[model samples]
Every structure is written in C-alpha cells, then in structure tokens.
Target: MKKSSFILMSMLLVFTMFVAGCGKSENNNASGETPKTETETPKESEAPKKDVSLRVFSTFGGTDTAREAFQAALDEFTSKNPNIKVENDTMSANDDGFRTKVNTDMTSGNEPDLLFYFVGADAKGFVDAGKVVPLNDILDSDSTWKSGFSPAALENVRQKDGNIYAVPLTGFYEGLFVNKKIFEDNKLELPTDWDKMKTAVQTLSKKGIIPLAAPFDQSHYVIEHFILSAAGSKGHNSGLADGIDPNWEKGYAAMKELYDLGAFPKDAATIDLGMASNYYGEGKAAMILEGSWAMGNWKDPAVLDNTTVIPFPAMPGGVGTGKDVIGGFGSGFYLSKSTFDNADKKDAAIALLKHMTSPAVIEKIALANGGTPAAAGVEIKGKTQTATEGFAMVANADSVNNPIDTMVAPETFSTLRAGVQAVVTGKKTPADVLKEAKDIEDANKK
Candidate 1:
C-alpha cells in the first residue's frame, strides 16, 4: 500500500510541472510573435511636429504696453496650438523705421508673414509686389470674421484695388483730452465752438498752464490734429480724402489760427506726442490735441484720473461738425506668400491666425489692454479711461479721414514732417506749410 501511494504522489507532481512548463512556453510564443515595442512603432506620433512658425514684423512699438498685451495674447495662442508658433522679428512704432523695413524687405522678397503697414500707397505697393494677400476670401468664408468688425473698420483696410490688406484694433479720432477738474476749477464750461475753445485756452494760460499740449517732434500726430481741426473749420467730412481731390481747398487757414493762438507749450516745436502726453498726464497742460490712443495711457495709475476727451472744438461754418474723426484702420496678422505656399506651415499658420483673432481672443486682447477691436462684434472687455473715450469718439463721428502721411507717396511723409516743423518753429507760416504740401502733392499727381 505504501509503495502504491508514493508512486501516485510522484505522478501528480510530474503532471503539475508539465502544465506549468506548457503555460510558460505559450506565454513566450505570444510575446515573441510581435516584437514591435511601443518605441518601435511608426514614429509619426513622436516626431517633433514640423516646427510651424510664422514670422511677424509690425509697426507697433515693442516698448509700448499695447505691444506687450498683444504679445501675451500671442503666447496664449501658441500654448493652445502646439503645432504653430509666431516669431515677432521687428517692431517700428512710427512711420520712418516702419517704411524702411517694409521697402527693404518687400523688395528683397524677405517679407514677414504679417506686418503693420499704411492703407493707401503702402497697401498698393504690397499688392504690386505680389506680397499682401487679399483677406476677402477669409472674410467671406468665416461668418465670425465678417460679422465681428464694424464697416468703418473694414473700409480702412480696403485698397483702391478692392483688396483687403489689414485690419485695425482701434478706431482713432482726433480730439481734445482735457483735465475736467482743471476746467471746472477755473469755472470754465466745456468748449463747444472755436471761439469758446480759444477763450478757454487764454483763460487756462493765465493760470500758468499751457492751454493745450501739442507735440511737434512727431509730425504725424500734429498733422492729423491740424487736418481734423481744419476739416471742422471747412465743414469737410473726410478731410484726408478731400485733400486728395484736386478741387479741394484743404484746411490751411484754420490751421493758421491754432498756430497763432499760442495754444501749445513753449517748446512745442520739439515736443513729440509722447512728451505731450506726459505733459497732459502730469497736469503741465490743461489739454492735448491727440487721438484715441491717449486714453490708453490714462489707465496707468501714474496718470491723473480726472481727464475727459472731446472732439476738436466745432468750427462755425466748417463742413466737418464735431462728429468727424481723423484716423486710419487697425492692423491685422499677415501671412507671407511664401508661408502660404508651404503645406504644413500654411495649415498651421492659418489655424493659429484664426485662433488668435477669434471672438474670444479679440475680446480678451481689447479688454486686457485698453484697446478697440479690429474683429467685428467682439465687445471691448476692460474699460480703460482712454479706450472708453476713444470708442465714444468713434461712435459720435460722422466721417473718418485717413492720415495724410498714409495717403501720400513715399518720402512725402518726410516732406510733410518738415513742413510741420517749419510752422511750429515759426520758420514757415501756416500758408507756407500748406503750399509746400500742395506742391508735393501736385508733383505726385502730375
């Protein structure tokens, strides 16, 4: 019996070992059949997505807070879309450096994917170069794109060729920003007409304050102001476009009155808009003849809180009433013809562009930075003092005039600047300035 029991136990142990060995063999077969590990699979998922980057050059000064806010928005966009990237290559706030960059790059075939440029001749030049893409298709295809912007905003971006080159974030109006407290303290009512404004200036000056802060160093701003005022004096609705017409007399005489009133600082000839803004912000001057951009600076804690913006004081018989605004269109992101030619980068670039200018992004940018919207229907979020005032000016304006510098041919900006300098420095009278500009324009027309 004992021998039988030992034999049975030995047999069961052998059977158990055999089953375990068989299971181990089956596992190895299954594992060895497919040798492709996760790492060994097609690398399409891991290959660093073709680095899609868009290079942008702009006229917005990088140092300005507005530029910084836009950059933040761009960063948010890139974070959400890992496949696309934007490279800000250059920023030129004023026209001089901006034009140099545009001409140099446009002629060299090294244009950026996006750029901030002028409306008339500059837009024409880009189209002639076969560079700027018409945004009509983009606008037509996307309801949000077409519906988000104001018609006035769209009009500014359209070229004579009926192509859209850019979009603007702000609708600027040339207006007077005054220290309300200062005026009320002086017992002065808000100036409603030219005579009242002139009187207000004299009264303010008597109190040892410069009546208005008008910058001379940056001729562009000064020119816009003068044009708006003159338009008001002549009753011209669109002063800039009117200036282009051969039959237009232009607003020279009205400009002369502002020049003679001693309305500006003692060294007004050398003051730039930036300096003039400082003068107004610090209360060194009672008011400033500036654009909607001025309101943006007021949001800063360093600026006075008691500021108010009003349109250029009315001219009795001028064609432009208090409602006419002087400003051009806003800017938009651009894509290089070369980038759009590439397959992967093109898809990524367009995707990112759409994302950045989407309703959400536009509202975010405008609200965060005290700016207006280039995208339609997106309400501005944050109400900075200046941005709010700026929008009011736009809403109240009956017409908008393009900047004279933007309308003219190349080098004409320089000529206009020089003429402005002559007037502010007392070297050339207002008539001389107007005649010089007319001569330049006439030559260009011929």
Candidate 2:
C-alpha cells in the first residue's frame, strides 16, 4: 500500500477502536422528545468522542526504518484505545534544524502535543520556557507507572524544581568492546587490573594489532575513553563521577599514558565511531570503548559477529577497579500541558503514553535495537553485540557511574565535553583542562 494510505488506515482503525469503547451521549427531555428539559439533569458527563488528533514531534530523522517502527507503535496504541489519533512530525539530524523547528512551532502556538527530549540543557530550556508539561501530577496519581522506572533513570529527566517533565525510554551504557577471538588466539588472559591491562595492550600492539579502537571525529567518544581510563584506575566510588575536572587528575594521567603508548590508532583523532567499528570488525583493532547503542549496528549480520563486551580493565589502587565504569539513561519522552488540558485529547494521549511504554513495547524496542529496556523483567527476543557487551559491562561494574552529561547542569555540559576532548587530543595538558573546567563551572554558578 502507499505510505499515505497506510497512515490514514492505521489512524482510522485507532479512532474506531476508541470510539467503540465509550458510551454515546444524546440530549433529550424527560418527556422523551428532543427539547430542553424543565429540570436540568445533574449527572457526570459522558466521555468525549474519540475523534481527537494529536501531533508528536520527534528527532528520529524519519528514515524508512524509524518511520516503520513509529507507525507500528502508533498502530498498536490506537488498536488498544480506538479513540485517539496520533500523527508524527519527524525532524532532521542537523542539531540546529530541530531547534529551529521546535522554536517556530512554540512561537506560532502550533506546538506539538508531545516531544522526544535529550536530557540536560535542551530539556531544561523547554521546562524553563514553560513549553513542557510538569508530569508530577500524572506520576503521583499512577503508582504502577511511578514504580516501574529506576530512580537513577527517572532523575535524568526530572526538572530542577522536583517536577518530572519526561519519562525515560531506555539507557545506554558505555564500555569496552573486546574481540574475544583475538584474546584467545594470542593466549592472552583478560585483564582484571591496571598492570594486566597495560601488559595486554602492549603485548597485542607488539603483534601489529591496535589494542584500542577510538573514533576521534566524535570528540565525546574520545573523551569518554579518557574518563573510563580514570574511572577504572580510581575505582567507581572515588567521587570522580564528575568528568574532566581537576578532581579527576588521576584518571587523566592514566588516559595520557595510554595515548603515549599508542593504544589507539595512529590517526585515532580522525576516526569516527563507524570507523572504529570497522577497525574492530576487520580485525585491525582489539577493542573499542563505545555506548551500548552501538551494539545494534555492530551486530548487523553483515558485520563481524564474534565480538563481546566487557568493562574497562582495572587499575591497581584505583577507585572501583576495572569493574566499575560509567553509564545512564540515554533519551526521554515528554508531554505538553496544552495537550493534556483538553479533556478528549488528554485521555487519548495518556492512553498512548501508557501503551507505548508497556512491557511488550519495551521488549520489542530492546530486541530490535539491542539496547536494555527501562521497564523491568521485560523479555526481548534477541541481543545485539553492543547490547550483550553493555550487559557484560553492567554486570562487571561494582557500581555504574552516571555519565556527566546526564547529571550536570546544561551550561556545564559543553564545558565538560570540551575539556575532556582537549586532554584526549593532547591539545591541552590535563591540569590546564581541569583549571578551565573549574573556571567555567564557577562562572556558570555566578
């Protein structure tokens, strides 16, 4: 079927399902004629008809793959409710493009009913502008919903004023993706401490294999490797969950040593995440530090299929040893107060939210994308290389440190990312980077 016709049919089916469930209402007098009643009847009004339509804004880029998944989700939601109709407005990948679209919509009083948000400054701005709804009431009224999410996961999306504006969909953990075959082929044991890890990298490098694969084009990934190197050395509880600051000196020192040893590629600074994956998939590198989201793509049957994930190796006398690493909730969903205030629209949107977040939906998304589900005990069909790797890292971690971007204030995020990138790229000394970060934080506070 044509795409437009498909969407229309899906929406129509949804409207039918919802309308079928609600009782119809009519106005009549006690005499059973269509006339104004002498005594107005006092009773609860009937639920509104299920013909309401809501628009959802998203940054999924609307690729055919994403569109198919979204349509499936909407179709399922409508099938269950049969009252609400949801249409999606997908945005482009260009960061400015999305911000422009949202801003335009907000100003024109044509804002969507819901939006997908990335936690931190982006979501904070919307909350500050009163463009997003405070979900505190909904959360408080629904016990099962409130209890379903992990506190750490939920905290990332909560507003500073103790009100929740978004519901997290899932979390992506970052870790080292190791080539198990390489380790076994070299008769090398997996490293559990700092000394062993260094020895392994050096040994593997001597054999003409790059020990670590890092995509340098994405500065954040490069910086995260540095952060993990420190976290692994310092241990997970050293209060260095704060990234790239002066307090994280020990971590920086460790990262610098790895750079000096040439653990990453000769031009690691230029390689993006995809290039890093190619390095590992083609057997040019032994491991890469990446987010769990990468798992889905890495596990594509077309790519190498023998890789496995593990925590960053340990460092002697470090905070939490190699077993402790960093991770947190990756993305979120939010509701608009304007949408919820309309009685017919409100019930329809709420029902959609609940259905899309149900255990079944969570499992499908996880299985399809190879990421972990936010909802507990939801069983998915399969695992991707990245997801399995993420699970391994999570399992090994004595504790998972929050990704700095998820925990720190918005203005500080850019400062933190830049500082870490500077150190990783050898453009700035660790001390210099740390000092700069401190100044930025201090200034933001003022």
Candidate 3:
C-alpha cells in the first residue's frame, strides 16, 4: 500500500506517519547564536578529557519500557567519555507533572544539558524562547551523525521557522488494543466500526469486564483516538485558529455514548493512567487505548498472546474513516543553548547527544519499547506480534495523524479533557465543551 504522510510526518513504510512536510527555510541563521568556527567547534573527536557533569531530563524513568535501554546507552557514553558525568534526571510521561516540570525548568533558566521531549507544540515555547539551540548546523557539520538519521525523521521534526531543533530517535503509533480471547469467549466481534464497538462494550460490560481501561485525568490516548476517529486527519490537524469543526463535538459525543454504556472502569474518574494500564495488563479489561511503547508494560502472557491492534473506529456522525491512525515521530532530544555555549561542557553534551541518538542505540530503544526506529534501514528485531501487527495497521491507515494536543494549545487540550467527565455524566453537552475549548484556543493565540 502507498503510505500517506499525516499532518506532521511523512512516513516511509509501516508503523509510521506522513507529517505534512513543510518547506525547509532558506536561511540557517534564525537561531539566536552564531555558529562556532572550525577551530572553536565542539566535536566528539576533539573534546578534551576533563571532569564535566551534565544533567539530562526525559520521560524515560520509572515504569517506562525504555528506561533500562536508555540508561545503558548513557552508561556506554559515560564509560567511553570517562571525564563526563551524566545525571539521568527523568519523570514518568504518565504523570501530569511531566510537562509542567519540563516547562518550569526550561523557563527558570535551569534547563538540562539534554532534554528529551515532544518535537512540536510542547517544544515551541522553549524553542522560540531560545532556551535550546538549533542543531541544524551541528548536524550538518558531522557527516557521520547527520547521515545516521532517516531524512524523513529529521524533516518531520523541523519547527515552523524551518530549523530543526530536536533530533529524533524513534517514531510511534497509537491504536485500540483488543483482547481476542475475551471477544471469543463472549462470542463478540472485534470492534472494527462504531456498531461493533458498541456491541462489544455492552457485551463486555454486562459480563463485568471493563470494556475500555482508561482514566479521566491522563486520558491522552483516549482523547487522541476519539478526536481522530471523529474529525479525520484534515480536521484533526485543522487547529482551532479558524474555528471549531462540528466533527470535534461528535468525538466527545461518542465518548459519552461509550461512557453511558459502561465502557470505562468505575473508578476511572479518579484513577491515573498507570492504574488504568494496570487493569488492562492484569487482563481485567477487554480493550485499551495505548501507544506502541505500551507493549512491554503488558506482562501477562495470556494478554500478550491474545493482543492485536486496530485504528479506533470512526463514530456515527463523524467524517473520519475507520482506518485513520494517530502517530508519528512525535518527540526527541534537544541540546540546551546554555550547554552549547559552555566551552567546558559543549563537547560533552554534543557527544552524548550524538551517542544517544546513534543508529545502534536507536535500534535498541526501539526494540525495547516497540517504537519505530528513526534511523533509516535500522531494522528492529524480536518485536512482539502485537507490535508487528500495529506496524501493518499504521501502514494501512487512511491518515496517520499527530495527537490533537500537538495541534491545539495545551490549555485547550486540557479543557477538552476536563470536559469528558462533565459530558459523559450529562452535565454538559458536546457542543458546549467544544465551544469552551475553542474559546481557550483563540485566547491562547492572543
């Protein structure tokens, strides 16, 4: 099948996205600082061997599947560069505080030497604020490192200004994970479309099994898929700058429709993502909304054996095709501006970034977490069946969209999330929620 590039990605093959490729800017001087000349340039090969400590912050800690692989990569870097010490500062991506901590540190002048975060809207603030240095020159200067990345991976991460700020390691795709065994036992069909999905939810819920294991607070995946399922790719990427799409309301309405039918866990109102995932991992939930990175976290052999992924079905009143997916090269590591200018640490930070994102390390992390490796021709080995099938799903998608959060203001996305409970419980209409979210989006642009 010919894989179409989604809003922010132009994927090459299976399990990837085709983000809209923006024209690369002609000028390379947008980043505030001037490039270092040959003599003063920091190269991994020319770094002086001396004691230097660097802190790197990311979402690679706690129960993250890539935690050990990431640390091992760092350990290898630190071992080779014995003079450099790396403080592995990390937070779980599931936590509400993850973005808050990153923003706080970036704005407070306490930015880490290396930051692993989202590539788009989330990084826009810091990137525009000049907290991080654009790596275009550095990447160009090193032919070996520059050639290691897939051209599309690098291109999709380019900021609106046409400069590449974040260096990508892996891309990702999100899907609806179905437990085949449960469906079989209940004599139900896979939720390939809205009617089938509702049937499964009603059947599973009647049998006392959670139809969909999702939390209200960290409803990232839920919101993403629902919106994509309702609005389709073009509408999903059509940020609120123009106006709210009517299909957007249908997304929320579909969520309420599922909620009224007992799709979510009873304690979903208060449980966090971890708890919701725990329910799915323990085999108490028949289905879940998660990304490829979740493959390692679901430990039950039975669950793993029965697992398969599909794009969330389009809702009844929405324009989305059931084949649309949510995914892309969403995030990567950034070299802090402060670190780049510090002569003592410049070489160390750049070297570490190079080493961490090297093709070999990218393969390892991708294997561990089921992320699509960003390095061209770097094949991931021993991926689970679910992961492999998810690749096929992405390759077959009508449109693979970036998460709605990336397209909208953070506050606007937050408002949409906040309205889920209110909408599901009959306290608010879907139109009201969309209006409130659109208002917030408009205000944020001011």
Candidate 4:
C-alpha cells in the first residue's frame, strides 16, 4: 500500500511539471517571445508594400536636349526605385501653352506630384496660391544638397518674401551667334563694335547672305538683346518699370537701321524661330542673335564647327559696353504641396526631387544642353567652340540682367513684344512704339 501511494504521488508531481511547461510555452507564444535558435532569424512580414504612383509635369518635351537629359535621369531613378512609378506629363519647352495647362490644373486643385517651370514672377501666382511646397526645409535638412548650388543660383529662385520655392537647374545667357566660315570666306572682320556690326550687315546683305536670321513674328530674343545692349542692366531694370526709356528709342532706331539695311531675312515678319534657326544652321544667315538654349539646334557638324558667339556690340551712348548679359537661373523645379503632404509617398517624392537636382544630374543636363549649370563647381567639358564663346561671354560679363519680359507684368510684356515687332516691321516708329508701351505700363500701374 505504501509503494502504491509513492507511485501515485510521483505521477502527480510529473503531471504538475508538464502543466507548468505547457503554461510557460503558451505564455511565450502569447508574448511573442519565441525562443530563437542559433541558426534562426526573425521573419519579415510577408505582406507586400503598397505600390506608389507619382504624377510629374515638365515643360521639357519634344526634341529638346533638356527633355532627353531629364528623361535619362528619370529612367535612372526608376531603375533604382522599382516600386515607385512615375507618370510624366510633358509639353513643349518653349510653348506658352504649358503654363496655361499648369495654371488650369492648379486652379482646379489637380496639381501634379512634381512640376518643372519658371521661377520668379512667373511662378508667384502658384506659390501664392499655396500650391507649391516651400523648399527651405528640405534644403536646410540636407547640407550636402544645399551646398551643391551657388548662392546666386539660390537667390535667383527666392521669392520677394525671402523664401526659396524652387530648385534651379540651369543658368542662361543671350548673345550674338555668328557663322565664322561665312565671315572668313567673305573676307569680312568679325564685328566688335557698333560700326563694325553695321558694316558687316551692309557687306553681308550685298553678298546676298541674310545678315541676321531674325524671327520677329514669334520671338522677342533679338529685340530683348538690342534693348539690353542699348539700355544696359541699370537702364533696363529701371527703365522698363518706369515706362519706356529714351534708351529703348535708341535701341529701336538701331533695329530700324538694320531692317533698312536688309540685315534680316526677307520673310522675317512671317517666319518663326524654327525657320530662323534653320537659316542659321544651314549657313544661309551670317549671324543670329539668340540665347544659349539655341546652341543645341545647331547640330550640323559644319554649323557647329563654324559657329562663334559674342555679346552684341555696345550702342553709341548706351549704358553698357557690350559686357552686360541677360542671364540667370530662370527655370527650376517646383514641388507639389499635395505630394509633399501625402504620408504614403512624401519620402519617395522628396528622394526623387533630390535625385533630379543633384550635382551629377545638373552637370549631365548642362553638358547635354550647353547651358551654365546652376550647381556650383560643375564644369561642362568638350564644349563646341560656339559654346566656349558663349561661356566666355557670361564669364566676362560685368553685369547680368533678367529679360524684360521676365521682369515685367504679363500685360506689359505683351505690349512690349507687340510694339517691338511693329517697330521692326516698319508698322510703327520707335517713338510711337515707346508711347504705346508707356501707356500700357501706366495703365497697369493704375
């Protein structure tokens, strides 16, 4: 009997021990403290991450080098981040229609995840509407990225309120692009002054070579250059706001003289910028007054080989000695408030933005597009002689001014554009054009 009692007690003790082990096992499972083995690893959640889609808009479209470079960078980004898909909505870089589309979209509260557009007054409405994300925080947080840009480049995109709203990609300059072969073959000296330019115009016209490939119908480039060259930086910045200055009249008189000398194509009043570019590329025109952006259009080997760029000669009694340039960081990328506000995609969007504006990307764009890189310390090598000369013009400049159209109200710019065209086509005298411009400016001021 005593032995039976001992066996039963032993069985009971064993049962208690088993129960305690089971309880401990259950508690470990419940507490998520499962014992790990030497070779075991924690399992990652099997649930797939939610895919993100981003909508991006840009003015760099069509056959432009900027478009191509942008696409290349975008492609690289997508390759690096396969989870995020980007939808590119692009339009012609030079078209005013893109601005209309963006304005419409913003008004409807359908802003894209990313946008590439002009900075400054052109973007003030969007910025004021609270559609864009102020980039100061992002830039401040990333010292590496912030250091990539020059202070002048950053200042160029700063609004009147002293806040940066965009990331500038390129700097631009305007100058006279000459066909060197044409001048050399004709035994004519390169124009270095106003009198030399006039003589070249007369000589080239007599030789049946279109002296200047000007497109008065659609482009205000030459007109802007002439005005800036005549008025200089100080006069241009101050005069345009105060109504038409007498300097503008002198600029117009010079343009009229060129027109009378048959310096422009016969169809200048009807032709667009494309036709003018074609003439310049084919060596049909001796010169074309254009911005650095136009350098990409002259891809023909002969044209590239023969091209050279120089600042327009200083006009008599003008404020500048042909050393002031119309250039700065004019265009940049703007972030969408919606994108930055989205919790799911904000990080990815910011990462993409940083990638796009990175020094490497800026250098690539500048090299491919032939413009001054907004990012500091980025040098574009292997440039054509024309591009080299363009760079020299910018490097040697004493002052740089924003284009008048960019600095003035839209209505004022429209009037100035139309008035300049009319003066160039002989439809109105310089004084008459200036009067009309001043009236427009005065009305806007009122």
| Highest lDDT scorer | 3
Candidate closer to the true structure by TM-score (higher is better), 1 or 4: 4
Q: What's the CA error at residue 152 for candidate 2, in Å?
A: 6.8
* Residue range 2-43, candidate 4, lDDT tens digits: 999999999999999999998998899899997666988767
lDDT of 2 at 319: 46
In model 3, the runs with Cα more than 4 Å from the true position are 1-48
- For residues 1-446, what per-residue lDDT tens digits would candidate 2 score against the true structure? 99999999999999987776432323233436654468977779998665878888876553222345555787888776566678877864324357667767765778788777566545655667787788777877988887776666678556558877777766667777777778888887765566666877888888889888874444455455455555543432232235443335666667667767767787776666567766776777877876665554453443346567677765443443556666666566777767777776877777777766666666666665555577766644335544555676676677666555444444455565555556766888777766666566566546
* Tens digits of per-residue lDDT for model 3, 83-167: 8899999999988798999999999999999999998777778888999999999999999999999998898888888899999
For candidate 4, the per-residue lDDT at 132 reads 88
TM-score of each: 0.79, 0.73, 0.88, 0.90
Candidate 1: minimum summed lDDT over ten consecutive residues — where? Answer: 239-248
Error of 1 at 156 (Å): 3.8
Rank list by lDDT? 3, 4, 1, 2
lDDT of 3: 0.88
Of 3 and 4, the candidate ranking higher by TM-score: 4
C-alpha positional error of residue 186 in candidate 4 after TM-score superposition, expressed in Å: 1.4
For model 1, what is the alpha-carbon lDDT of residue 168?
A: 53
Candidate order by TM-score, decreasing, is 4, 3, 1, 2
Candidate 1 residue lDDT tens string, 95-188 = 3566777788877988877665566655556667778677788778987667867776787777767877665555445667778877888988
lDDT for model 1 comes to: 0.65
